[model samples]
Target: MSDEGRLIAGRYRLIERIGRGGMGTVWRAEDEALGREIALKRLHAQQHLSEDELATVHERTRREARSAARIAHPNVVVVHDVLDDEGLPCIVMEYVHGTTLGALLKGGGALPPGEAARVGLGMVAALRAAHAAGVLHRDVKPGNVLLGGNGRVVLTDFGIAMATGTSTLTKTGEIIGSIDYIAPERMRGHKPGPTADLWALGATLFQSVEGRPPFRRATAMETAYAIAVDPLAPMKQAGPLEPLIEMLLAKDPDERPSAEETERALRVVASEAPGATMGTATGGTTEVAWASAVPSRATATVAATGPTTSAGATLTDSGSGSVPPTPISGGGSGSAGDGTGRPRRKRRRLLWSAAAVTLAAAAVAGGLYAVTADDGGHGRKGSGTATAPTASEPSPVPAGFRLVREKTLGVTFPVPDGWKRDGRASAEQVTYTDPSGLVGLTIGTVNPAGANPESHFQNIEANTKLNYSTYRKLRMQRTTFQGKPAAVWEFTFQGQVRAFRAIDFGFGEEGGTEYDIYLSAPEAQWDTHRPVFDTVKAGFRVG
Candidate 1:
């Protein structure tokens, strides 16, 4: 039997070798401490290095372990313990049961749009969190993405990710991560920053959807050429994804859409996702962090185009580049500008849907025809202008189809593809259900401006029409969402547990502030669908 198969560090009994990478060996092990499974990554202790050299290597490993432990993100692999056995270091991490994106791609080709969007969104969200904590994931390629049990997507192997604000343990100007995914500027010996990771994400997203990277070369020089000199080839099978692929693969790091933009854009396709968040029962990561709060040109579009898109609007970051707070044009001007991903002043005060109505209002309220009374200006009695009152039309619904609507206490949304939306309009609530009766898509909207999410939850419990008493008993609790402060509520209803997960923001919905909340189904399906709320939750943006 090989030494690799032997157990190490006493309690972690190695069952078998699952994988081998350049830096470590991963073994399926029993964590007797918790009596659950874990991935034990041990440095090649048997390698031919001197005792002092071994000590130095393990010292670096320990530093990485400490760095990784502080991440505390769902997308990044969770590191449970670092053990020293026989003077060598071993890291115990959460064991992921699903295949890596690399393995998935090796067996086949590009992923479909929804799956691709899901993966891309997960990766971007992970990078955003990491960057906020001042860490740069130098090695952010597909091989490092781990699909965990419970369909959780995690970015792994933070061994090379380093803190950005200071020159810590890592060597100065020492390039790390994969060579193939390195940004062109970094390849030329420039200091790597958040932008570098964005470039890598573009490369990774391209490969995930097109079956090949944006650049491929037999030699390092040719690889650099592909990234530096040549224009990226249009991804063959990527359709509407053309926009995302273009943004992710943009040559200028600054031009790439922020991680938030990528995630928001993905929601259009992911909204109809039938299963788990990604629905594949696993996850992966491979993107970089955006620079700051302002919207970048890559993600922001001028409103010369129509206001409504099947995809949702981008939310600006709250940091350095945030858009200035000011009102623009008649309520929402004809266009919205983006700064560091925030909604420009013009896009404020209305979710994109209201913009449609506003446009029509603009057309109807023009000039003397405004003189018409409450009956509408169309052929007003004795008014000088009877010119077939110009009407601004909303986009056409498909033939033989009528749009349905749904809502909860304070929130409402349109059902696009016949999930049979049914709910109240003016009362500020909505609900949706497909034929199968699995999902209880209930929503509550509130313009709780002066109140925080906590007080607002209390308000929701008191006013909701169904199970108000039981819901009040659940009581809202605060918890971490990805990296944001979030509120959650768990309750029992009719022999099943129901959980609501939400993050609060002052949204411009229907000319008011809204809580923009989401609730998972009863317990029978909670485990199956709760993750979907996160996907939908990310789509909620405030201008």
Candidate 2:
């Protein structure tokens, strides 16, 4: 019978069925009391299951609501209330106006690398929030991801999520997840952890950019085998995301990059995405890409032989009732080693030199410029003399520019009219970011200046190189600023999704206060944005 127009809990009146998955049916409903629309999920009835099994399902439904409730993040869907109606559990969720990433991919072949990175950033943000709350989103496939019309990429459906310290709902030796997205370790019956979710995210990203899952076979059993034993299918269009995806899909969880590193990498890529902006309300047919309900498939269940050692044979069950041990192969493309005997962890560093070369070529072709302090209109390269008015003596703000005086940092500088102060500013430093969030200008102070500014920058560069796989130095040299010992350091590094160029000018006397003026922007647009740095430098003043 149709449940249309039915009132549940004497409050929610069902409007229409929006989605149906294995576990439940979601309805667009009106909360008459609250006067707002909500999504209500009614647990699917399994009449054939025993009483005990039914109770387990009920408990899992409750846990799903609880698991999602624990996390309060913008990227995660909001769970409002849980109600018991006619002995079945119904969950009320914030109705999102958008479509699933799966639906978008199905309708549109594949997203461009930059656009895919933009979506990946939202997904990673949701995952990070979940992990921080000790929750594991075991089922993180594209179908469960909601793209809201307001430009919010949300991760929904915590139906199979497992919070830390929670007991397993499924029986021993049984795996519950989409076969194609299952992590290799999970396929081997190892205890799934945060890395397992990351593995699924990698697979999701692969599909987003490549238009198909990494592993797809004729049958579920064969797909399982591919995930656990087969080499990763070669990628054709992953672009900058290829290396990160390869590392995330490594069979060994230890080989995967941490969530923090993944976010940084994704941000770098998303920064370069054309027309990439979150939280903007879109309309018309384009709204379909942001929000709409898509059918959710039930997670498949497969029986495994038993837990095996990391080096032991993997056991999988074929639907024909045969259980066989799949011997672990050595040095496949999917293995932790990148086919060259070098561990995948070290491969990211190799990208640094190559990216550096590309950035250098682009800069040269684009006529890269540098920030220079005015010196009687003599355009000597890397001029460090300060001619701008001091903080005590303010000068006229140039057209299309605004002078910002920061008392905490004891400095004043001119920034583009549209740039706004970043919330990350603190007592130590102040930063203003462009509207696009890609470029930034920062003014900071060092209480005790170092013996030499150049040496201090070199020390900092050493650490930056270690953390950033694509860090490349253009120059680090000693100079004079306002008759004070100073240094100018310039370099380029790959952000989570794109390349960026940065320059820093530090000037001060030994044992006295040091001032730092820094600017960074997209390497591709460096030529056009480079003059902003020059403006800031020309107008920079210290007390």
Candidate 3:
């Protein structure tokens, strides 16, 4: 039956086609029962598939709906329902009424770093939620991210998600997802993981700011080969994002930072980047990162006029740069100013040396720490506003130390006079270190909300043991801190250049907030640094 103006499952009324791909067509439809619009997707060539292939495709569509439905984060699209229409499977999804990120790039060219960072944070949140639910979104690209009219950046199209420990659905040795964005490990036939999704996120961010994916080529085979064997070209337009992009695109999944770490870096970028390059009608900044590189004004003019598309050579992948966009309005203001959009404050450039340096660099580059309100178990409302400590009732400093009060974390502590603050501070964590970088002190919080304290440590220890090199646990026991339930953990591990010992204490606050203090040093010299940990714990106070 013709889909246009037809009702499916006795409720959905197809209005018009919104998108097309090799395997399916997406239509804007209205849900008669719910009285709301939706996106209805159905296969394009169902008649061509053999019986077995058809079954597999059907299973895949059902899985896509399940996979997307499993995640409940704000940044993920909602799956409404799935049903059969004329013997073909159709997926009902929330209709996002804005342009795809791919389309935005096509129409506006490279986006400003601040805008890209904002978009990236939403994607990371979606991925984090999916990974936590044991789902791996196998396909993550610019086209799958929706920039919604409600100002929500959502990740869509999880048609190829690999649910954890589930049996493989793809034929043996057949790769899936966009070739240009595929991780090196995936190309080598390794099972996909959370890091693989991160690699695709890196490619998406790169394309958002550079107007092209990093591994583009004339053919799919060449692009795959380049992804598998070649080094990433240096990013000239990425600026501070360069280090994060480089780390995410690491050839080895083991080398990529965890989702927690990546989110922190992106938050730093979002909080610090100046503003966005808005539409021409608003008279905002036109100085995109790659604007000077394009030689012809006519080509630039063509790029600016409408969506410019490129088709993927592989049938399974929806190619990069292909999108149909909707217009965007509402220019930037205030801190997100409308002028040249250059950074107004000086930021710490990414040192890009060792893991320690990477952490330190993020701190330097970040302007505001992500703040959270902890009401000592009384339900403190969350706020993003920074709260600098009052000049009158300053945190007290010890004789040989300086008092540091962080308005974001709403905490205060003392550090040795010679010690410098090196690590970044988010609402979640903060750090300080000696000039040598070997000895450090970190204060952090984990929102247990209501989970048991011991289980939290157990889970963290499990992940640490898996990821940390030559990790050894000395002690991890439930204890008491300042008359409160707490846990203590001690361990030793190999760093990139040396062996290190560390001690940690996590105490539960009245409102189910958990605060932790960690200290690390050279394994052989741990005793010399142990006293500093005691001193920090003694002086630490959270309001």
Best by lDDT: 2
- Which candidate should be chosen as best, given TM-score against the real structure? 2
- Give one digit per residue, the lDDT tens place, for model 1 in 72-98: 788877888998877668888888898
Ranking according to TM-score, highest score first: 2, 3, 1
Measured with C-alpha atoms, the lDDT of residue 56 in candidate 3 is: 88
| Regions of model 2 farther than 4 Å from truth | 277-543
Residue 527 of candidate 1: its Cα lDDT?
Answer: 49
- Which window of 10 residues has the lowest lDDT sum in candidate 1? 365-374
Prediction 1 global C-alpha lDDT: 0.47
Clashes (N, CA, C under 3 Å) per candidate: 25, 15, 5
| Tens-digit lDDT string for candidate 2 (1-543) | 478989999999999898898878999999999999999999988898899999999998899999999999999999999989899999999999988899998853688888888888889999999999999999999898899998889998888889999998987546787877888766655578898999999999999999988877544544554565444666899876776787677655655667876776676556545675643333333222211111111111111121111111112222222121111111112223433566544543343223323221211000001111112223533442346445456644678999888885577778899887754343445556676666656565554566766755654444334323456777777877667887777666543345556666777788776676666666787767767766776777786
Q: Across residues 313-336, which tens digit of lDDT does each residue of candidate 3 receive?
A: 001112222111000000011122
Model 2: weakest 10-residue lDDT segment is 363-372
Off by over 4 Å in 3: 275-543
Backbone clash total, candidate 2: 15
lDDT of each: 0.47, 0.64, 0.60
Pairs of residues clashing in candidate 3: 348-364, 376-510, 376-511, 377-510, 377-511
